[model samples]
Target: MAADLVRRLAAEALGTAMLVATVVGSGIMADRLTDDVALALLGNTVPTGAILFVLITILGPVSGAHFNPAVTLVSALQRALPWRAAGLYVVAQVLGGIAGTIVAHLMFDVPALALGAQPRTGMTQWLSESVATFGLLLTILIAARSRPQAVPALVGSYIVAAYWFTASTSFANPAVTLARALTPTFSGIRPDDVPLFIVAQLSGALLAAGFCRWFLAPEQAT
Candidate 1:
């Protein structure tokens, strides 16, 4: 059990690191390649979504591919994962995500620990985060229960759509949010705004969990 847990933790860390690297790296590349904001966003969004599908597909068997703290929290609440393991998962994810930011910075020849200046805050932003996370959790819970084989594709697709639809570009993961704050690149969020974004994300996750608990319940035989 201990050995298995260790492997799982390693998978989570590595997976999250790769995920964040894609996000930050793609954002940097996009910004440099284009002056058009929409085209740059497209560049960032496609790589992120593609990497997510690839990561989740390859890593899901090992650690359930929960690169997000919000996802881990919901899984623990649902008893799909133990609380202690969940805590470790969050730690690994956060550390890995931070490492990813550093990797992206090194790749781009930027300051490794620069604090983000991009201000991603305000009521609409918070609401977008809440909605984004809510949709993410709900999609995961429903798809995992019903069509487990399609989770990678479903999650990737949802994120792709969410990016275009949400006001905040759907930063639904706490670990990702925290990591992005360390980069002053196109994908970064202000350090000051991380806390509330996380709060909104967690709130959305819990709401999804609660709704699923009741909504996905097995129908009682009459």
Candidate 2:
């Protein structure tokens, strides 16, 4: 059991670290190559999607590859995971996100931009986060419960799509959002804005949990 727990936690941390690194690293590198944020964002999207697909497959057996609190929370609510394990997963994810951001800050040169940080506080930004998070949770539930084998590719595609569709660039992970705040480099959120974004994300996650309970009721009962 102890060994299993260690493996789970390690998977969670590694998955989350890869997630943040994929977004921040790719974005920063792209920005250095091209001045266009749009081009850079597009460039990041490909690798982000590819990485998520591979990571989910690689880590799913150990930790379910839930690199976000929202994903873990919703999964727990859906009975896909126990609350205890979900709690540990969330902690691991958050810590991984922070560590990944710190590494990105150290590795990349400082830019005029706020390190590809997430937006906070504005009504539009909050709304974007809410929508993005809802979509993320919804995707997880749908993918995991219905098409379990397809989860890796489906989730990766969904996240990449959400990035372009959502105003807040679909940063649906609170841990990742917080980690971004710590970096002043490519993808950091402002420290002042971190709390509000996290609040919005948590709220969105809770709402997704409730909705998933109702929508996936048949599956949950099984």
Candidate 3:
């Protein structure tokens, strides 16, 4: 890899690490502070959203702030990111996500890797994941085109809303879903259930990408 590409990959890894830390850490904090599941969820939702906006704002210029594999995949398909670089980005993201989860667990004095016991399965959960991921990708696609500066807040807002509306709590990023499976926290998903969530997320991301291609940027005739 070239020096520039190496730097960008490092940025992706570091940013994704921080993003996962923010999410898992916040979920742990919320679970500790509240008996009410609603209040705990609210606590989890707010910080995760806030952190996401901040991460994107700070990292956007460096590596396009693509902390999600689904987003990266779509970007590659759209020609925004080259396929080779996208593959590198996915590797970094997955590694960073696992490291971040371990860090969060350590910080909270929890086990390093827990295969989440809670079941996040079934068709309804899968559907919810699809919807959540679709909305998230669509939000990024539209905002990035019309108001580039607003992408951070727009994405944060959409995710915050999705957390409540979707049964899967909007695990829109495959990296995140995989990392969350290692935690026995409020946000954790069972390891066995990760595949379905990933499949749903990918499907949704592709659908959004296709829609954006058709409507937002129509193909030119040969």
Candidate 4:
């Protein structure tokens, strides 16, 4: 059991690290290649969605591919994961995400720990985050229940859509939001705004979980 937990933790950390690396790295690459913000966003979006699909497909069995603290929290609330393990998962994800930012910075020959100056705050952004996370959790819950095999694809697709639709570009994940704050790049968010983003995400996730509990309940035989 101990060994299994260790493996799960490692998988979570590694998956989150790779996810953040792709996010930050792609943002940097896109920024360098384009003066057009829309095009740069497109460049960032595709790679992020693609990487999520790949990582979830490859690591799903190992750690359930929960690279987000919000996901982990919802799972724990649903009793799909133990609380202790869920706490550890969040820790692993946050640290791994930060490491990923550093790795991306080094790859692009920038300082590793620059604080983000990009201001990603305001009511619109917060509401967008809540909506983004609500949709994400709902997608995962419904897909996992109805078509377990399609969860990865559905999640990847949802994120792709959310990026274009949401005001905050659908950061929906707390670990990713925190990690992005460490990068002063196209994908970065201001560190000052991280707390509210996280709160909105968690609120959205919890709300989704609550809604699904009733919506997804098994029909009682008459």
Candidate 5:
């Protein structure tokens, strides 16, 4: 069982690294390919979604495909994930994300471990994160309960839409958010702005988990 857990954690870390690479790498590629911000974002969006679908589909069996600390926390809160396991999951995710950012920088020939300078603070950005994370958790929980098989595609598609809809580009994952802060690129966020974003994300995640608990809990037998 311990060996199994290690393997599962390895899957989480590797899957998360790939996910971040997909997001940051595509954003860099998009920015280089287009002068138009809209076009650049469009370039970034599709690949991120596509890779997420692939990652989740492939890694779901091993780690429940949770690449986000917010998701892990929610799962633990609902007793779906054990507390110790959740801790390991979150640590693996953060470390994996940082490594992924470095890989992205290396691939682009950008300075490795450069801090993002983009100012992403303010109420609008914070609110957007909350909304984005809330929707993400809601999607995961509801989809897992109703149509488990379609989760990967649904999550991927929802992220694509969230990228367009949210002001902060739908950075709904804390691990992803922290990793983005390491790159001074199109997808990067200011390091200073990270705490606010994470706070809002956690709040949103917790609230969404509450709603899911009530909504998905089996009712008393007649």
Candidate 6:
């Protein structure tokens, strides 16, 4: 049991690091394609989603693949994971994200960007973030509850879509956004904008967690 727990923690750290690496690495590529934001984004989206899908499947059994703090909190609130595990997982994810961002910055020879903060509170931007984050959380809960077989594709596709559709570019993962700030690449967020975006994401996640109670129902959740 102890060995399994250790493995799970390590998996969480490694998986999160990979996720951040994808974001930062892609950002570096996108920066080279700067004049064309759309193309740059497209370039980044494919690998980001693809890697996320594979990582989730690879690490899901071991760490439950809660690469985002919001995901971990939501899962724990639903009793899908223990509270202690949730906190530890969040810490690992955050650290991994930071490490990944740093490595990507050095590897790509780009100055680190500000923390990847969520976009600000313009009506459209805020709505975009709220919707994006809500969609991500909703997708996870639904996949976990009903379509277990389809989770890999569903989660990946949802994130890919969110990146294009949302103004904040679907920074659904707070840890990821924070890490991205450390690198001035395609995926980095500005430190100044981090707090607001985080607030929005956390709020969105809380709403989603509440929605889960209704959507999944008491017996269904367990």
Decide which is better by TM-score, 4 or 5: 4
Query: Lowest-lDDT window of 10 residues in candidate 5?
Result: 213-222
lDDT for each residue of candidate 4 in 134-172, tens digit (9 for 90 to 100): 999999989887799998898999999999999999999
Best by lDDT: 1
- Candidate 5 local lDDT, 1-222, one digit each (tens): 999999889999998899998889999999998899999999999998999899999999999999999999999988998999999999999988998998988999998899998899999999999999999999999999779999999999999999999998899999999999999999999999999999999999998988877777773121
lDDT of all the models against the reference?
Answer: 0.95, 0.80, 0.91, 0.95, 0.93, 0.81
Q: Write the per-residue lDDT of candidate 1 for residues 1-222, one digit (tens) a residue.
A: 999999999999999999999999999999999999999999999999999999999999999999999999999987989999999999999999999999999999998889998999999999999999999999999999889999999999999999999999999999999999999999999999999999999999999999988888773221
User: Ten-residue segment with the worst summed lDDT in candidate 1?
Assistant: 213-222
Model with the higher TM-score, candidate 1 or 2 = 1
Error in Å for residue 203 of model 4 = 0.8
**Residue-wise C-alpha lDDT for candidate 6, range 1-222, written one tens digit per residue:** 778878888998899889998887887787686779888888888888999899988988888888899888888887878998888889998998888887777777765544444335566666676788888899988787788867878989999999898887888888987786676555766777776777788888889888877877965757
State the displacement of the C-alpha of residue 157, model 5, in Å, after optimal TM-score superposition.
0.5
- In candidate 5, list every pair of residues with a backbone clash: none
In model 2, where is the ten-residue run with the lowest total lDDT? 110-119
RMSD to truth, every model: 1.2, 2.8, 1.9, 1.2, 1.2, 2.4
lDDT (Cα, 0-100) at 64 in candidate 5: 97
Clashes of each: 0, 9, 0, 0, 0, 10
| Alpha-carbon TM-score of each model against the true structure | 0.98, 0.89, 0.96, 0.98, 0.97, 0.91
lDDT of 3: 0.91
* Better structure of 1 and 5 per lDDT: 1
Candidate 5 structure, TM-score to reference: 0.97
Candidate 4 off by > 4 Å = 218-222
